[model samples]
Target chain A: MDSYGLLIDFSACIGCKACMKACKEANNLPGDPGDHLSYSDYTVVKQQGDVFYRQMCMHCLTPTCVSVCPVGAMAKSPEGAITYDGSKCFGCRYCMVACPFSIPKYEWNKAVPVVRKCILCYSRIKEGKEPACAWVCPMGATRFGKRDRLLEIAHTRIARWPDRYIDHVFGEQEVGGTSVLMISPIAFSDIGMRNTLPNEPLPNLTWTILRKIPNIVITGGIVVGGVWWVINRRMELEKENSNGKEGKVEK
Target chain B: MGRKGKLKNKLFLFLPISLMALLGLFLTFKRFYYGLGSVTNLSDAFPWGLWVGFDVVCGVALAAGGFILTAIVYLFNAERYKPVLRPAILTAFLGYILVAVGLLFDLGKPWNIWHPMVMYNPHSVMFEVAWCVILYLSVLALEFGSIVAEALKWKKVVNIFHAVAVPLVLTGVLLSTLHQSSLGSLFLIVPQKLHPLWYSSLLPLHFFLSAVAVGFATVILESYTSSKFLKRGLELDLLVDLGRFLWFALVVHLTVRWQDLFVSGALANYRPGSLEAIAFNLEMALLIGAVVLLTIRRTHRSKLGLFFAAMFALFGVIVNRLNVSIVGMLSDTQSGYFPAFSEIIITAFLAMMGFVAFFTCVHFLPIFPQEDHNAKAELKVQLSA
Candidate 1:
């Protein structure tokens, strides 16, 4: 099966934020050159010290936002973008909480708000064009291609310049392999990225407990039911003995 | 008092509540029309605020008295506890209704609230919570409806409800267990965001255990307050026994919490003067205080002492939930969130609605089981002599 992904080299980025502007124009989102992501901004160019990092959705192989959505509003597409349909959403905001990278942004200002996030330019990709951010990068910092190719490119860049780049690829195996991979000149955590996420997907953590509900309910019901019968029966016998009668029996 | 005096008393009581509810309704209308941003202090950094923390989490835990009493009376056949069961169920029913109302206001698209009903997502913890709450509320209705039927002299309906009472109560218990834990499961994902002290793989277990403890405590508080306000039987003996059960529940909760912390090795993150630390200490102190008070023979025997212990336990659970959902998330961020005035007003309004509904039920319905308080008082006097 064909897979798609983005490989961003922070070492090559110039912090120009041209890609951020292009993303805004392409998505028809409001304009603001900020370091943090917001509802009106799908992507942002964050500068930490001397290095520039583009922040957006990771679109995990096992996305917790997709898993935790009660109304099946979010889903991972076959073409490799995490897509969302707000029409089916009840706006529980579990997606905003479940996201490891905190990618999802809420339009709290809107009367009928839904979760907003990076769709990875899935529509542009379908039309045989690169994502707006990738297309506008003059420095060739943001590369878009197949998921396997991106991994190969990330590793090659890291290996080609051992002294210039960090040894690690940020999203290669983080919270189970995100489609948006990153190779940084410095530590990823130094640039506001969470470093301690387990390689395993986070949805599995919640599912582990939720899967046991059926067994607990069944066993708990039987035990409580048994106790009820025994106690009530004993009470009935004691009453009959004392009164020398049926003790106000009824169905 | 004369009829005019009685009317004056009721007006005095309901006037403020009605005003608050109306004000809350006006704000709610504005909230829907203008959006959450206009009213709430929610942001991307802190998406959840007072409504999610208090109205949903704490409110549901407080309502747990219903399921606890149901299990004690119907499941364990503890008939001595029967007098408080109807009131407990009524509290739970109103509590859950308020939870739903809170969600309605909290959601971005309030009109699309029924999406979960049609769309199924088994993987989500919220799906379980939604389904469980909906089903449990229905069960609670039937349970409460039986009381209404009894009061209204509908013997046939009362008999039919009684025939199905066992299954209904059991269903309610199962549903309560699932959702109570699922509320905690909702926070399991944000390990980096939530403080290490509050976050754990065993969060669901902690939530369930604390809810059970809070449930018993709420029963005591409700009964005490009801008797005081409504001039009804105190049922002190039953409340004392319930207080004893609260002690055991609190012990189990504290034991499991400390054990989980130890096993997870999260104690390393404990900073003595940190906000998380202070909140954690306060929560522990309240629960421990309740346990200690209830353990002493004299305190457990006295209604006033039992009331204080129950209040402390309830407060502990409330703080614990808020700490987990809101305060825990604040540790990692430079910016902090506090609820807006509208949010606080709405919460108070809902609480007032619950109090009003509870008393209305007590006034009209045969909620307290037919027990001879005077005879019980005489027996206590005789035993003491």
Candidate 2:
């Protein structure tokens, strides 16, 4: 099966947001309304001191949103992009809950709102093209390729510049891995990556409980419901035989 | 005078609902014709409005009486409680219908609702909730079918219904368990978005426990209303029994709830506008207060105390559902979504419909058992004691 991923190398990079500009134009997205509460930049450059952070959907291997949605609205394509179908969306905002990265933004300002996020340009990929963000990154900072090759490349860069690179690949272990990998100079946690997470995928935790719900409910219902039946039957037998002779109802 | 008294009682039912029903009718038109956006405060940020918070999640939980009642009468074999069975079933049926109606208003594309209904999406938690609701509604209807059949003098049909009642009740209980808990599980995906205090693996469990408590509380509330309006004997035994159940549910709910808080270490963040914390606290306090009052032997014995405790528990559970769905959920921008006046009125209308439907059933059918008359005799005997 064909697999794909995006790799962003911060150390080798410039801070120009050509990727964001290309993304907006390529996707026919409207201009930003100029607010933090608003998101026109599918990909943006965030600078903490001289360090520039380009952030968008990490396109996790195991997405939390996919597991939690009741209607299967947000989904992970086999090709590795975290794609969404607004037509299937229920407006529950549960997707907002599942995404630890807080990447999925709901169109809250609009009355008929749906969630919006980067798909790594699934449309372009379907047309056998790279995501506009990677294609337009002039610094050669963002590279799109197979997951295996990206990992090899990321590791080679780190080994080549031990003093310049943080040992950790941002998406390698976070939330059970991601399609998008990042190489940074500082600690990954410095850019707000959640450091404290179990090695297993988050869906594992919820999935374990979710899988057992039907069984537990069936068994719990039978046991609890059985007791109710026996008690009710005995009461019925008594009620019918006594024929209102009793003073207080024996509930 | 006797006929006039009957008419006066009928008037009592209509008095509470007429305006609300009319408004509900109007909104029912508006929601379908105009779309949810026209009349609601729902934004993309807050897609679910009062209808979802108040109706589907909390509304159905409030109506959990059907599951509990079925569990009590057909499963556990609680006999003396039979007097209120019909009323409880009727209350549940109407509660579910109201939830269904409420959902019709909340969906963004109500017209395309049938897509999910027809096309099976096993992965969607919503699909599970929807099927459970649909199947359970029918189960409830079948479980309560005997009552209507009994009233209609369909002796053969009533006998057939009685034979199936146990299984139907069991089905209803099972279906209810799926959806009632699934309601909370719906948020399991929103782990990052929900306020940490309310988010836990045990959400479904919390929902299940609260639904059980609320189910009994709803019946108690209805029973109190029944006693006053029907001039029937208030069944204090059921209240005492329900109180016992509520005490157990409260202890478990409190333990699990606080355990979640304690482990989450989220208790430190408690303050106003921390919707989940406030909601969690309110749920705990309301149930605890109800347990305290009703657990006292004398308190359950009194008509007024029992009535109030039941009402409080009902309100508490309702508030808890609303909080988990709306208030407790967190986003970076804490935009408070107040439901439009029209939204609130539509909710009121549905509630009025519930009461009116319940009253209509009780009046026409032999829903309140003749045994309720014995309460007066029991009271006289107590007086002598």
Best by DockQ: 1
DockQ of each: 0.62, 0.27
Give the 10-residue window scoring lowest on summed lDDT in candidate 2 chain A. Answer: A32-41
C-alpha lDDT of residue B117 in model 2 = 68
> Which docking class does model 1 fall in?
medium
Candidate 1: clashing pairs of residues: none
Off by over 4 Å in 2: A10-16, A30-52, A86-93, A105-115, A158-167, A184-199, A221-251, B1-38, B43-49, B115-124, B150-156, B259-280, B331-333, B336-343, B363-366, B370-385
Indicate the DockQ of the complex predicted as candidate 1: 0.62
Q: How many Å off is the CA of B62 in candidate 1?
A: 0.5
How displaced is residue B33 in candidate 1, in Å?
A: 0.9
lDDT of 2 at A251: 37
Residue A69's C-alpha lDDT in candidate 2? 65
lDDT of 1 by residue, A1-251 (tens): 36688889999999898988888888888757566799888888888888888899988989999999999999998888999998998788988877988889998888888899999898999998999999999999999999898899889877888999989998888999899999998898898888889999999998898889889999988887888788877777877787788546442
For all predicted structures, in order, the TM-scores are: 0.94, 0.82
